[model samples]
Target: MQKKIVKMFDEIAPSYDIVNRIVSFGSDKLWRKIAIKKSLKHLPKNPKILDVACGSGDMIEEWKKYTDNIIGLDPSQKMLEVARKRFPEIKFYQGLAQNLPFDDKSFDVISISFGIRNVVEIQKAIEEFARVLKKEGILLILEFTKPEKKSTIRNCIDFYSNKILPKIGGIISGNKEAYEYLPNSIQKFYTLNELCEKLNKKFEVIEAKNFKLSPASMIIAKKI
Candidate 1:
């Protein structure tokens, strides 16, 4: 799964950001803004943030408004190349989330946005997120969630994500499977209660909010 993800992301590196913006109707930036603001709430006095699966460093760039001690990590070198080009001053590393290359308690805040679903070992990845964070450090995860309402809105989202998103994403990224995997993975991903259960094993949940009509969510937890 890791190899597949690396190849897929590498293949779409050149146009991933463009497709993301288009497919999200330019709401991707807004979502990142919300994640950053949420992170700031529990950020340390001299916060050092680690952004796991920091694709194209979008979250890292948004985080700069709040802190300068930022490190972006991703498994795809192609994605890191794009991130480096965009934010030359910020640090970018090619690494996996399940096995982070950092000392214990190295960061005051950790964040992953729309990337946790791709992790081959999701629990291991969460453990790693907990390991690198300082005691009481915050972990902010922004991910796609299954909507609670099962109505016209759900049907519309399903149609858009399953049928329309892949087609448009394929045309833009030239990798239809990547886009196809997007919705499929989200559908298979854990529910909010399930995720909180997993996270609570390592950290205490401070807040959990569902957005975009519960199709998107942000979970803020602190290491105990």
Candidate 2:
């Protein structure tokens, strides 16, 4: 599953950012800004950061506003190629979230935006996050979660994500199947509460915020 997802991302690498802007109406940037802002509150100035599953280095781009001591890890070479071209100074590694190629307590902050659900061994990945982060370090996650309940607004969101998003995203990205997997993955992913519970096992979950009219959510945690 992980290998297939990596290949899918690689195939969509060229149009990933463009399709995201169109589908999310550019709100993805706002969400990343919000997550980064919240993370800074608990982190020191110029903290060393690691962005896992850092597709196209979007979160790392946000992190660069504060510090340059950042590393990005992703499984898709094509995506990293785009990221490298965008930020030539930063080092990027091709690695899986479940197995990071780094020493223990190596980073002060670790972030994964919209990529946690892609990990097949999610708990192992969470453990790897804890292992690589220093004590009291920050963990920032921006993810799409399954809805807790049904509502009129949620139903509308479901329609857009499951039906409309694939068509528009497929048209723009030229990979309808990849866009289709987005909604299906969200449906099978953990809810906000469930994800926080998992984080709580290794970190103190400080905040979990849900965006209006969207399935995406952000989590800020501190390693315990």
Candidate 3:
């Protein structure tokens, strides 16, 4: 199943970025900008940052605006190929999050955006993040959350997310299952508190926030 996930991403690599922009109505771009600014407050100068599951490397590029000491890791070679083309000078490793290729205490900051949900062994990945990070190093996560059930607006967001998004994304990406899997994944994913609770096992939560009318979640934590 994990290898299938990687294959799906590889098949969609050409349209990944643009389909995201279209499907999210361009909100994803704005969300990343906000996430970067918010996460920056806790980062140190020249922090060795690693973006795990760094699809197409856009997030790494955004981080570069702050510091050049950044590298990206993704399981899909085609995705990494696009990323490498985008930032030729930056190093990218093809690897899994549960088994990172870095040494202990090697980085000051680590990030994974919208990609952690697909990880096969999420807890192991989080532990690896902790092991590779310097003591008190920052771990930033931006992921899709399952929405609450009580509001009319939230219901509408759910409809768009589960119904409309897959249709449009599938058409654009030429891979229906890939986009369909997204909504299903989001639905099955942890809630804000649930994920934060898991994260707290490895690190101290610094802050947690949500994007309006969407399941977008961000957590900034530090190694304990």
lDDT of 1 by residue, 1-224 (tens): 79998889988999998998888888878888987787687775658889999989888878888777889999998999999999898888889999999999899999899888889898999899889998999999999877655678778878899999999999988889999998898888887778888987899999888776336788999998
- The sequence of per-residue lDDT tens digits that candidate 2 reaches over residues 98-177 is 99999999999999999999999999999999999999999999999988888899999999999999999899888999
TM-score of 3: 0.97
| Candidates, ranked, TM-score | 2, 3, 1
Name model 2 segments beyond 4 Å from true: none
Candidate 3 residue-wise lDDT, 1-224, digit = tens: 89999999999999998998888888877788888888778878778999999999878878988888998999999999999999999999999999999999999999999999999789999999999999899998999987655588878888988789889988988888898899889888888778889887889999988888788989899999
What's the CA error at residue 94 for candidate 1, in Å?
1.1
Worst 10 residues of 2 by lDDT: 58-67
Q: Write down the worst ten-residue block by lDDT for model 3.
A: 146-155
Clashing pairs in 1: none
Query: Which whole-number lDDT from 0 to 100 does residue 142 have in model 3?
Result: 91
Kindly report which residue stretches of model 1 are placed more than 4 angstroms away from their true locations once superposed: none
Best by lDDT: 2
Model 3 residue 101 distance off true place after TM-score fit, in angstroms: 0.4
TM-score of each: 0.96, 0.98, 0.97
Ranking by lDDT: 2, 3, 1
**Backbone atom clashes (below 3 Å) for every candidate:** 0, 0, 0
